[model samples]
Target: MPRKAPSITHKRSRASKPKVTTGCLTCKVRRIKCDESKPHCNRCLRTGRNCDGYAPPLPRPTAITTQPTSTIAHLPSLSAVLISLPGTPSERHSFHFFLSHTAPQLRGLFESPFWSQHVLQACLREEAIWHAAVALGAVHGRFYAEGGEGGERQMWEGEGFAIKQYVKAISCLTRRGGGERRIDVALMACVLFTCFESLRGHHAPALVHLDNGVNLLLELQSLEKPRNLITQTYPPTPYTPLSALQALLTRLDTQATQLLPSRHTRLHPVSTPPTHYETFISLEEAQRASDELWNYCLYTLQPSYPSPYLHPQPQPSHDDLAHRQASYATALTTYLTTKPPRTAREQQAGHMLRLHTLVATLSLSTTSLPASEDVWDTHTPSFAAIVDLARRIIDLDTDVDIYAPETGRVGLDTGVLGPLYLTALRCRDPMVRREAVELLKKERRREGLWDSTLLAIVAERAVGIEEGGCKSELDTGRISDVDVVFDPEGCRAGVRFLLEGGRGSVEGHRGLVLTTDLPRGQNTY
Candidate 1:
């Protein structure tokens, strides 16, 4: 019965439906198909007008309905509405006021010294300190601030995120090789020390941190290669080289020694306790303090920042100059207190001479002066003391080699060697100039370190000599000798001098050359 009823069912077909055809303009207006034929379309041609192919109008969602007819009836034109908008008018008028008043205030906070101090002192918690250190380490200056209530708010939030990142990195580093047990504690210590120092001002506590870091580095007994200290506990990441940390600590210690003389007046002992407000009272005491500081610094450098693979080769240990100076100062005090030498006068003279020599050497070693006008104000006092000590050493023993490699190059005593070339150039001393030439000549023979500035300085100083006369006109390929070399960018600096008819020529060689017009023979030569 079912089959009989199905006998009346419809037959199946496989053909597809045909697409509709319409003129371009009509299709477009009606939001439908266009036949896309050339020449005039049927509709347009019939109407005796140009025909354009169909373009569908954009569809509006059904959800968006037009405003009520009554509301639209009273509506103004777009232009009128825009002109009357309250916020738009106010924004246009306050544009300059916003730029002038607001932008500078924001920029000023960024550059303010107080802001940095506040960040360092007020926000330095474990997490904040860690993140700030990472930010510094990563050199990511852009992550400094983001959206927040104020500059300080941004600083706190950004730094907080950065700290979290830092702690993760630290954990990663510790777990790198296998686990925390395999972590490079020395490297960690150094990283920790650096963070503490950066957060806190350079203080004795900072030194202690550095010392502890070094000790931790020394504790890493394993000498493994490609060992991931952080991966031992967490996951893999990057780490700064341990040597770099050691170098940083060394530099910091050196800076501290340089700063101490100004910070503490009782640096050296004097017979009369020289009433000069700036006089250092006891060099011996200063030396002890300096030695203690140096020991602490060195102690921090060890195991705290160990070599990644094999243990570092041992190097000769040099005593801190400040410590040595303190010792000599104490000896001077003892000598000054001694009764006038009568019996065994030769022995007393010899002892006094030895003491003087020691004091001179100590002074030379402890001082480091700036050689340029730019840093003169900052470095003058420290350098002046060092220079004075160097001069005194040279006076006491003319034969002494201040920079002798065998004697542990103590100070900038130039003597026959010439004042330290950098110092000589800075001080503009002739003796130092001659010494620099000799040193340069030696360096050239040994290391090929000659440069244009060095040559220029030499040429400038050699003006009086017949062969090396200061002609101002440099020969082709002639190198300029000076304290510092000029970069190509800086070489253009002579343009003003050239334009003003200075002694040097600027017409030839495509605007390069500061020299006299040479004779044909000299030019050829």
Candidate 2:
């Protein structure tokens, strides 16, 4: 009242707006309030002006260049230009090759993009991951580049680069403690190393790296354990794509475990039934059973006592074998008899399930058979099942290829070669057996380290031994043009070759020798 009487003007106070220091250039130029959303600012979008993109963030000026702590603040940001600095020409070439080819090959027909997305991101921030990725790329490049001029030289060069990077990665990872971020990088590096070795056909090294990666993953997964049931349900923590990677690494573990001697088989948490399964077997359950059956067969075929410092390997009892066989049978029935799959992915899954089922069946039945009986005779039903499954898979793949020629039947280890190899070895009917052999020869690529060419050679050798090939035919290479190919149904009339092929005592032992030599010791199909 006194101010009004004095003719004083009252001004309304105004609240200061938030400074848009980090907004896009367009907004800053326009001098308007900006809600700094990604890709474009709201103010700019509302005004219909072209938005100049965000500037690169500047790192906060710190007196300390390197911090001893492992906190996220101390960790380098993904924006750092040095994070993904380009490598040498060859390295760049290999990495590009990996992005274009190897990455796609690493995934299943229906698998998550863990390798391509999560691992690729981790690789950007970690030196160990970078090395491992480059190493894998180099190995893959060499694999494709084989048989070209200077191929051996190129292979050796790639090997040298891979080994050097591998050693560096191991060193860097070992120096890093179990910090959450560090552990993620370390686990990714370990997995990439495993892939590197598998691509290079060194399975023993691959298994060792797989063990390391799996251990790290288990450690990480355990950390998020809740203090109470309430906490577990109230706030669900965001999940990383690493779990998908862990699943993949677990599978690699299972396969590598089969290659290991019996003493190495332990309780792989990854291979156990998952907590999520309720009424029916999921893909993981099917895979776990398939791998367990395969591992069990390895133990059955080559049982060995542990070192004196460790306990001996446990043998599966007859009841255990029966239970496992029945479980696999049920799973197979469920997968096959289920309603027709609506998607291509579902169709591919069914194919894989059948493949696993047939392989598991063959493994179980063969291992359970009395050692005295002819292996071929005792496992005829299993062989028949495999033949039926293989034919169905081929037909399905044919249909798929006819519709979409680019994606031609999941060649990167769809579990086809293993079952096919076994089928070729055990089936006596040249027609069916040759169909298996024909598949192997045509595939002509590495199914995760089981080289199709190598398998074809071994399968053909076994076929020649089981189907009575003269030593001269084998030695002189005169077995060429031996009509081994035939139609699936047309080859149904069984033609059994005498085990004894008149090459004397040596020839009589050929079957035994070939069987013994079939991926023995550290080797696996």
Candidate 3:
């Protein structure tokens, strides 16, 4: 009956079950089924809830693309650019390729308004436009040598171009700011001088550049004083930049005419004597210029990285060449002969003296000598001169000794003196040997000589003399029936006899004898 009723009723099919739905938190809060779409579901929008989309994690950035900010990155690249441009076209090409790629990055930095402004602000605050100028110079130099395939000639050209660009860029950077920086200009001038010096066949130009640079540096130096330039504001005043420009100009004026000797003077200085004076002046100026630059690098610029051009200078050794040897000898002789320098700077005079002594010893060892049985005959005068110098130095020590507490130790130790005496003994000349022996004995007497090694040498010489025996003193008195006495310890007996007996008479057995009847110890012969 129930089934017949349902069929007959034609009643609407049981209402379809409502679809089950779940919502995200945002949708649920609004009491709505969420499409659960990431970021913003419809339910979240209806409820006015914030629906943050699912954020996939961002991948880490790669390293190669990282940009450089300061001078550190530029220096190595600059050095690479310079060194690579010196050999072959291949090298030049490679360098060019590197520069071409890197230039864009540099250009990017240069074109950046933000970076430019920052640089300007930095230049104003620190007066360090030199850094910027140097960088610019490097860039320009690379750009200038734009052409060249890999070849040695190309490499040279590339290098030359780089140098030129460096000079020009520095010049530009340091130039008075028509909105430009001034310290950069001065630094550029200085760098130009340096470049000139480093380049072969460019000494004359280098001098010109140096003079210009010096003038600028001097002007800048004057401006560094607080009284000359005021700097107590937010963005520092423009005094430094202006001063730097002035400095560059001044150095340019001074260095241009003074770099090298003229061709005429190099061949015949007497004929063109004025050239000699000019050359000397030039050398002095160059030295002064170098010193000034070094000071600037140390004090003013205070570079974070060492200069690329600065290489470890190789020290000259004694055996470098014949010319070197002669030069060393001349220098030593000159220093030794000259009056001692007085200032704190010349405090190295003591060291110089030591060096001279070492040179003299080396000279003795190396100097050729003619064959001679006598050591003095070989090199008597030279040895005497050396000894004299040594004595003079020793005397200085003694002079210092009087004020020991104030002056500290005086003179070298006995260790040195002992060797000097041994050197004297090695002399072939008997007179020289005697003199050396006397000196050794004198040193022993003065220094309270206690070294065992020194004592052993003395002992050996004394033993040799005793074993060899010495000529006997001739006896003038006449005697009869002379009896000759010989003993193994005759040397000792002779010494004892000389000291004890005041008067004695004797005759040699082989020589003529005076015969007389006389008793032993009683008769007078």
Candidate 4:
């Protein structure tokens, strides 16, 4: 188990006694003082024992080490990375669960290398990341365990351990302070914390933490683009781990934009967004294009800064939004033609990208008429297409419940749920909307800011009141603009909407606002 230190040389005592340097690892373990023998240790040579010739212990790292700072910066922070491993048996188990189970869920369908690789690599070098990872793993297990199976005592105990780990992760980050690149470490921690809160059904706090990370990202290279926050959105380069982290955060930021109207100064754009791409030569290229275009499209909706202030981006003038829409759609169309799918996963990922493109296009058509709730009715065919795409995505996913157990309940980024939720709430057609509702009902998972089960209830109830009236399931009226406010705990949400015919005035929900709990099922949470 003893490894050679590359940077630190053998030391000598105050009395001028030289530290043991050349010796067999076996002799060193036996505490035999060496004669500083050359070629091979005399004792081991005489014993005819197999020797693991400890090549002069590799020198250990130090301030004086010749490695460049940039190179060193890329290495995991040793203060935490190599500081500690999970010590207790329970800690070990939870950390393993995080690696094998929870981490995979964080990846969603795209299998992001950030979750699967960079995070785990960070876990080794950073105590903060390790603690957070353990905490997340424990929370994931606690949430997904078979209902009434773990019992109250076991559940509470698991939660306590997770909380303890979460605190430790925080403490580790605090102790680190504003050391070099600490903000980057904090951004990664914010992501983990956001996921932890979301899985507990606490979306408000999840958004808060998610927003914290987003704010950090905006300021990350702000000096480079002093005025434009969106320009600082992504790394100028790729392949590095931070680039992957930035991509993940960009995707999450877009998720936040959809949930709440941001309050920040919307700067007028002078530069055009990245809309032109030749073709995808690699899977990485395809994903990068998808994420960039997706973010760009949604940014047009919520032109928010990292600051907290009322910023409304109602619609684009001069036909700007429509122009951007056509440009993005054209790029994606070119992708499908040039880079054909070789694997089933690639095909499904392609489907996911197209769904977002369609949703963005749909939003562009109606942003100009923000006051008209019925404007969505004009896009029923678009809604139907969205629903059909979602069905195919779910059917083709390798981790669907039919193929993988309990994989349906969690995701760290956007998925089919968002598009389906949009369709279910906006589309007036009963058949199309209900199909969206059914798909969401079956989806017990929480996809970042969107909880499918909770939204399914809202969509279904909206459909009911719009048509079902206060007493019956059959009617011709429609419901518009379901505004949902999720409780910080995520188990319950307040829903308010307008009824076209005002026929459901006397239902359980007084006026239009109603409070509802998350539906109960096999894996309700």
Quantify how close model 2 is to the true structure by its C-alpha RMSD in Å: 20.0
Worst 10-residue stretch by lDDT in candidate 2? 1-10
Candidate 1 per-residue C-alpha lDDT over 1-525 given as tens digits, one digit per residue, 9 for 90 to 100: 001012122222323323333446433322224456665456545434335444333222122121112111233322232233222222222211112111121112112221112122211212222333343322122111111113313323233443454455456444534332322233433434443332222233444555555444433324452346523432122123333333334434433333221121111110111211222234333233333333343333223333443354443233444444455455544643463333222222233333333423433443343322333224334334434543443333312211111111111101222223333333334444444443333221100111212333333333222123444343212222222211221111111112222244432422233322111110000
lDDT of each structure? 0.30, 0.51, 0.31, 0.60
Which residue runs does candidate 1 get wrong by more than 4 Å? 1-133, 137-158, 169-189, 200-209, 220-245, 253-525
Candidate 4 regions with alpha-carbon error over 4 angstroms: 1-85, 147-157, 178-181, 221-242, 261-272, 303-318, 399-409, 472-479, 498-524
Which residue ranges in model 3 land beyond 4 Å of their true spot?
A: 1-322, 335-376, 401-419, 444-525
Model 2 bad stretches (over 4 Å)? 1-93, 142-171, 174-187, 202-250, 256-285, 288-316, 391-414, 472-525
Q: Give the alpha carbon lDDT tens digit for every residue of 377-468 in model 3.
A: 44566556545544554444322211111111111112224334444434444454455444443331111111212322332232223223
Number of backbone clashes in candidate 2: 0
On residues 1-525, what C-alpha lDDT tens digit does candidate 2 reach at each position?
A: 000111111222324445445676555433346688987777666645556556553333222111122222222322342224355655555555455446655755544446435545545456666667778877666655442224233533636776786787777677776443344465567777867766555555665777777666554444245446323432132122445555566566555444222224432233432212222345545654555565455444454533332234355575576566666667556655765666544576677777676676656666666542255655656666776776665555533311111112222344676678767866656777887887766552455535554456556666765565536343321111111211122111111222332342332232211122222222111
Q: After superposition, how far is residue 15 of candidate 1 from its true place, in Å?
A: 79
RMSD of each: 35.1, 20.0, 38.3, 15.4
- The sequence of per-residue lDDT tens digits that candidate 4 reaches over residues 1-525 is 011122211221212223343455444333346544655567665655434344332223222111112212343322233223434556655675565457766776565667656676666556787788888878777765432232422633447788798899889877864323355568789989988777766667777887787667655534445455534343232223455656776667666656543232122222345534555565556566666655655656553344333233354452675676677677777877788876555677778878988987888788777556688878999999999998888777542311232334467657788898888778888899899988877654667767766666667777766666458433344554455565664355566664454435533432343334444222235
**How far off is residue 313 in model 4, in Å?**
13
